[model samples]
Target: MTEQPNMDAGAATGTKPLAFDRWLEHFRGNPAYHRLIEADIDWNGRSMLDEPTRQAFINSFQRFELGESGDGKRLLSKAALEGDPTYLAALELLVREEQKHSALFRRGLDHLEAPSLEAHWSDAAFTVLRRALGLRTELGLFLIVESVAMGYFTALAERAPDPVLRGIGLRIATDEQDHIRFQIDRLRQGFRNTPRAGRVLIGMAWTVIAGGAAAVLAVDHGPALRACGLSPARYWRQAMVGFRRAAHSVLANPGAEPLGPLGKGVH
Candidate 1:
């Protein structure tokens, strides 16, 4: 068997981070990609489920919908300040895509005859955290959400008894996989020029932040997760895999090979 290299190896020994010019093109393509998905959305689809499952989804998605409803002005302003118009325009499209997610969830709630909530403590806390931080820090926190979404939505898509709900979950989860890649690419650019020691420190801090977020997500959404046949431990484990992978991209050499395409549908 091939022995794995040390997990704690620092990024200082690697070549310079890859140029982000390619991401500009990728981001440019994203708006059209999003439009294609948007066109196919079936808002009138109904979700049929048991009472317990339905309530669990309602409670969980209400909070998630609120979280997704941010205006993203701060993120846009920060992106503009980066002096990359291509990146800034792409960020605008990304924000619109996220907004569509909120709308989709809201429409799902409507289909189930469940009320969508206007606020949640978890959403409030995240908003405050993002508002108090710089772009890099905010992106780090946002990454935790994407990581959790990967696990949570995958479970929902697989196990939800309602076919419409399953379809919605699968779509959102697919988009989330790409979102993780997008965020990591930008984060790698942010840390590209930092000293090795600084990179290590940032990595350590990000691990703590990501782990905490995962723990909180499990606690906050345990009921819905359980209803979807996912344990909190399993959810946290999957989220950590995503977080660690993203952190590695930023803190170490990602290698020459592409991360490549995500699997079709839910994993």
Candidate 2:
């Protein structure tokens, strides 16, 4: 196992000690998970009158689920192979929950009778990037993905005409919020421990990924937003605000101390 810096609860006098590991473990199976599962809506009866609108939503949802499941599985596998038991455990639970999310999205599509969804990013770019970077880099990417997903789900919940779809979106959005928080915390910690070049790479990668995801949403749901009483400019502005808020929170947090020379020992 990689040696992580042991945080002493009483080290900083007069200040509440930050219990990173404890908090991570505490949120492993958040109540939001159960709530989301329970609140999921059946979308079988609903119909999007426009073919383009229905197709776009189906494509977006499918790609989103595939991306999530792929990322989760990769993270869990890497953590386990690296012998980082704490991260591995956390990711194990997280991946399971993500699988549920993916399954629900898939089921929703089946209800709509949309065509089979294909992987969105099948090129070598993602694979090469993943191989070149470490877990920290992956987490940075995930932070952006989850943050954008939160916005997309929130919009879906507000606009979806079907009660079940709306309920599902709300519940999923809640869980997504928790996921975003967890990822942001992890990114902060990663920034602290990672090398300068690595940190810069992470930041750049996050920006690119965030931008790409946002574009995907815009392309997929532009009309949907209009239908929901939101203009293009308004939806874009709201999305920007949400993304910035999430990014700011991650950047602002003073993270855990770096492992420093101990990082060498881990290798």
Candidate 3:
């Protein structure tokens, strides 16, 4: 895949140039994963979780479900205006995949006999933040969220009592890992030509964002994390580890991090 034109960066900051074609192909080939998760997991049964854990999971995943519910219209508009066509295409698929997550979460809520929230302050905050910034800045914030999500779902996948719920968690976590890399790729390319001083400021901001986000999520999802046998302290630690891995990789001079594999059929 050819290196697409840059937004501000002269070339990709990463040693590996941007390959939006492969990214697009990767997104296109991954839809089957969601379908497999849906088919293999029986999402129609009632939760077998203990009373406290059951309600906690319902509340927590519901919030996350709402987080994934946004339609991404503004995001797509920004992508079209300033990003590579191939990236915009890949991003559209990414947004659709997030929507699929919402559907899966909705099904999970029904299975747990819980009603989904009509609104959430956390979801509203994320919407406002993304809309408040440029595409690059939005992506930076998005990367933090995705990185944190990887930790949250991984906890559940490994520790949640319900096997079906664990299945859902693992599938979502798998997708989030890819999503984090996608954002990192875009960010490295976007910021490649940024002056060292500007990079410093950006890195500082990301550090604060990463720290604050981990704390807030730990508090908000404390019950669910505890139910999954992950303490808030441990969850925060894991979240920060993932966050630093993503943030540093993006803030680095030339990312040597390899792009994840081509999806099943995209190779």
Instruction: List per-prediction Cα lDDT, in the order shown.
Output: 0.72, 0.57, 0.78
Q: Which candidate number maximizes lDDT?
A: 3
Model 3 lowest lDDT segment of ten: 1-10
Window of ten residues with lowest summed lDDT in model 1: 1-10
Q: Which digits, one per residue and each the tens of the lDDT, describe model 2 over residues 1-267?
A: 122232222332334333346434544546554654555555555665467666656766666556555545566655555444564566566666677677667766676576545555532355556665557566665666677656667766777655655555665676666666666665565444445555445456556677776666676566665555556567666666666666666654436442111110001
RMSD of 1: 6.5
Question: Runs in model 3 with CA error above 4 Å?
Answer: 1-17, 255-258, 261-267
Q: What ranking emerges by lDDT with the best candidate at the front?
A: 3, 1, 2
User: 107-209 in candidate 3: lDDT tens per residue?
Assistant: 7788788889899888888788789777778888899888876778888778888877887887787777788878877887776666767777777888788
Output the TM-score of candidate 1. Answer: 0.83
Model 3 residue 115 CA deviation in Å = 0.9
lDDT of 2 at 38: 59
- List clash counts for every candidate, in order: 0, 1, 0
- Cα displacement (Å) at residue 51, model 1: 1.2
Tell how far residue 227 is off in model 3, in angstroms: 1.2
The true-versus-predicted C-alpha distance at residue 58 of model 3, in Å, is 1.2
Candidate 1 per-residue C-alpha lDDT over 1-267 given as tens digits, one digit per residue, 9 for 90 to 100: 111122112234464433445555665566566565556656676565778778888888888889889899988886676555655776687787789889888878887798889778888888887887777777767876787568888887778767667767877887788777777766665665566777787778878888888898898888888988888998899889888887887668523233433544445
Write down the lDDT that model 2 would get. 0.57
